[model samples]
Target: MAGQGSGGNVIAAICNIFFPGLGQLVQGRILAALIFAILFFGGAALWFLIVPAIIAGIVYIWAIIDAAKYKGP
Candidate 1:
């Protein structure tokens, strides 16, 4: 059971890796998905600035880690 659960987490993490918030959507976290997508894309749009790039990277990494650990509220 532990392995199975971890497998699911790995899958979700992979999904989020490709696209921010995708794992949240897959996990049925609609609000989180929307929020993450918005923050991710918004930050990405500001990529011309070095700060936004760093911020976006941070948010993107957070999204991935969050999606992996999310257990539904």
Candidate 2:
């Protein structure tokens, strides 16, 4: 069930690697995409601080994993 070929979810996750919410947008999860986009870009905007940068990195990675693992209609 998981890790089945290069399916849409896989593609989504790959897209997320480049931009945190891109995968969600591709998957048609508009709200989730918006949240991810806001957090990612908001944090990125304040990435001058070390803490914000680290947090943004963590959120980015989480978004990637979430996109890869999401299972739903």
Q: Which number leads on TM-score?
A: 2
Please write out the lDDT profile of model 1 over residues 1-73, one tens digit for every residue: 1332577667777899999989878777889888888888888998998787788888899988987776654
TM-score of each: 0.83, 0.85
Every candidate's lDDT: 0.80, 0.84
Tens digits of per-residue lDDT for model 2, 1-73 = 2443448789999999988999988888899998888888888889888787788888899889888888865
Q: Where's the lowest-lDDT run of ten residues in candidate 2?
A: 1-10
For all candidates, what are the clash counts? 0, 0
lDDT of 2 at 18: 88
In model 2, the runs with Cα more than 4 Å from the true position are: 1-6
TM accuracy, model 2: 0.85
Best by lDDT: 2
